[model samples]
Target: MSLKITDECINCDVCEPECPNGAISQGPDIYVIDPNMCTECVGHYDTPQCMEVCPVDCIITGVEESREVLEERYRIISGQKVA
Candidate 1:
């Protein structure tokens, strides 16, 4: 599942750089994660980088999407399907 930044986000811009997929971006009030681009660090890190760096614990995993769903989502975002 993709992670999301809650209202608790302090707009400190800390989490933006932690995302490996470049899914995190500065939003109107807080950081935003593009679910399409987010693999929850599945192929990059041991865990969600944004959640690890968030100072206020504002980042949380969204509804748990299955690995199949996640892989498909990643494929769509990356424009390549896995074999």
Candidate 2:
């Protein structure tokens, strides 16, 4: 599933660079993940990179998406259509 940054995010900017898909971006206060670009790192890594580098462990799964959905998202981001 797609990950979401929680309120625990300190706006540390650590997670931003970790996202390979460039899904993570600076929000009004915390980091936000663009669902359209979020693939849970399926195409690039074994695990989510943002969650890996988040100091506060604020990143969590199950944010309005499922694994199948995320996989489709990855395909879309990689210029492939979900079949």
Could you say which candidate leads in lDDT? 2
Q: Cα RMSDs of all predictions?
A: 1.9, 1.8
Q: Whole-model lDDT for model 1 versus the true structure? A: 0.80
Model 2 per-residue lDDT tens digits across residues 1-83: 36788898999888889888999999998889887788889878998888888888999885666778777888888888779
C-alpha lDDT score of every prediction, in listed order:
0.80, 0.84
In order, how many clashes per candidate? 0, 0
Query: What TM-score would you give candidate 2 relative to the actual structure?
Result: 0.85
> What lDDT, from 0 to 1, does candidate 2 have?
0.84
Question: What's model 1's TM-score?
Answer: 0.83
Q: Candidate 2, which ten residues in sequence have the lowest lDDT sum?
A: 62-71
